[model samples]
Target: MAHPDARGNPCSSSSLPAREAAEQALWRLMSFYDTPLADLDAAMAADPAWALPHVMKAGFLLSLTEPTLAREADAHLSHARALARHATPRERAHLQAVQLVLEGRWHAACRVWDELLIEHPRDALALQWVQLWDFYRGDAHGLRARPARVLPAWDEADPLYAHVLALHAFGLEENNLYPQAEEAGRRALASNPRVPWAVHAVAHVMEMQGRFEEGSAWLRQHQAQWAEGNGFAGHLWWHKSLFRLEALDIKGVLRLVDAHLSGDALQITLQRVDAAALLWRLHLLGEDVSAHAAGVLADWALGEGCAGDYAFNDVHAVATMVAAGAHGQAEGWVARCAERALGAEDARRTNHLMAREVGLPLMRGLLAFSRGDADEAVDLIYPVRSGAQRFGGSHAQRDLIDQTLLAAAALGQRRALGRALVNERCMAKPVTPLTRHWLEKLALPEAAQA
Candidate 1:
């Protein structure tokens, strides 16, 4: 007998215990908690003939964006495929999507999930996976639109309703819909305070609006909920560090790095990305972060095998290398990225297009800035500044490019350009202390009044 999942979607599992175990794993995954894999293993052990657990396992591994894990993911997908004959249409669709993901076709996989959602609007697994890929692809429109499309079909009393609201909140925040985003995020927290993604979405709204103090207070207020035993703890700490950076509290940012962002804790690529981004920000502010950068660089283990697999990861790898003063390695990595982006075989991959159009230039610009070629940095980054979203990251993550370009303009003594960029930022948000400091550094006429 097929079991209906939490959302009443039929799952291809005859064993009730296996179905229950898979549901628990799905909850853990949707909540961003650790140990989903263990539950999944239990599910598979409960019923080796079930396909849903195998499909879920494959999706989880593929989402990590680690090339080395592809084979293991493929193995799981094969198990799911072998059981496809007994699977429901939804389960079969999931198998197809995982296969696409293993093929390095993320966009197509997302489409498969999209179609699945259209047919099964209550499929929380499909909703969560697609939202993550939308984020990874920098599809702000898809982020906001997809959730909006499926949200009406979700009942507020559903177990995963808060998670869906949190996803929508992030999408809204990413699209610059601050007020609506905050309202939705607060609503999610009101429903369930442990939703870290809701906490993260609200934080993005604060960061973008230059609510530095409020942002710090917000993260600190939710520290107990988001920090303990949560997979997103490192990223929440990174958000706290961003607030500290804006306040010019370099020491405080360093303290956060030491406490949460470094050492053995930096195990995953996401955590490493956050560490490198924080370190790179410090480096841009004229701070000597060589020691920390060296640690992050060492953990990156950059090699030909992983090169250009994901443009976002490649960009951060280069940032780590540059911050560590490994200019030679950084240059080589950039060259490799260029070669991969141009290679005929890789040209069909989505990441190749991202690398060629945005990632390569951003890497080159960061390298130029590190090498004291401010003019080259400005030239390389300025043209792509508006479309930096193409490279895939939140506005906060992409701000490093803006910061670098502004710094390049000021340091290179390009008066007109420097003033223009300064004014642009000032107009975007109220002049924070950091913006005032940049004005002073640029010797803008308004610096005296600021």
Candidate 2:
């Protein structure tokens, strides 16, 4: 049994000096987002049981690193919950909220956000999450509505405002409203050079117009900016992955996945998990993800205590199994841990086929195309609606949904689908490089004419 702190929170380390340092680290994080995570990490290393720092650490991973480590971050969240200051219900709720995100519970995550928002209407992070949570629930109206309430109080001078604005732009872009989407994206990124989501939003502008080279070149240069010195959101690599695939340069996708995702943390962190999921999807698309990727996912699975989600984790689980080429092994794990893959619509459902349904179909569609089943490939494409940007992930991870469907149209030479996909992208920033390249295979005369 762990010792409790003065507030009766479960304590991880018995050392007074270490606990004191971690305490300071926690205060620092809440006060400013710019502190070196390395310092907080040092505090954690000294006393792993210190709950607040871990909560902040989870925030760091989600913001500054990969978005995938929600599970491992939840381990810290678990301790935070167990050790939470019961008197401070709001903070306790925040701990539970962090756990909810780790669990991939979109609705529950939203409920948590709503509760927090009701209590602290000015909580910017909660407001940002409300929109993102609505995104994953696949409700465009909800996505737009939440932000509308907050944008009045939100300042473009604040970087997070632009980050949130990027999501609004993405929803508009996804819904096929180009001019407004472009303007929103431009405003978001203009507020902060670090707003890659918005930058990618603008890149969508370039992509829709058929300037594949221009769009690709533009986002390519912005990669370092997104992955460094800002609150982390690197799943944009998934967007880039689609671009590389569009180019039909398998090596380009592989190298990018490797370069961006090659290294991972010792413990399963969110950043590493985020990297793993994207790269694993790429690996399934014929890139070689490192052999140890499966081992890493396994480690994350072992570090349980996450609450809320079945969609995100199940998606990653399927990707891990698919990437390892261990369907039989995965089926066994699925049977044992069978509760993870059910859809949100079913009360009894546990897991979701997010990767299997959206991401894997593309990989499988490519495989089917290779095997001369273009019709079947097209059949696998699903009608997609994003509930929240980070419900499963942001516009970046789910962009594959569009690319996959486009691949279907391109493969089958379905002129209507191809044109529709192009038109849809045209309303936003544009298609990403991956979709453009994929569409090129169909060789639309209009594309050439443009």
Best by lDDT: 1
The worst-scoring run of ten residues by lDDT in candidate 2 lies at 301-310
TM-score, predicted candidate 1 vs. hidden true structure: 0.98
- Candidate 2: misplaced stretches above 4 Å? 1-96, 99-105, 131-139, 155-176, 204-211, 220-224, 227-234, 237-241, 244-254, 263-391, 394-396, 399-450
lDDT of 2 by residue, 1-450 (tens): 444443334444676766566545443333233454666677667766555566656654543223445556766676676656432455556566656655545567677877776655545546655665565555566665565555666555543567668767776765556788889987876776566667767765554455556556767777667655433334555456555555556787667656664454223344455655565545534455546466556555432323123344444554555565656544444443334333334343212444334433443443454345666656654433332233345454555455545655665656577677776665654454444554465676656543
lDDT of 1 by residue, 289-402 (tens): 989989987776575578888888898889889889999999999998888888987455778888888999999998998899999999898888888787788999988887
Which residue ranges in model 1 land beyond 4 Å of their true spot? none
* Candidate achieving the largest TM-score: 1
- What is the TM-score (0 to 1) of candidate 2? 0.60
The lDDT of each candidate is 0.88, 0.54
Backbone clashes for every candidate come to: 0, 38
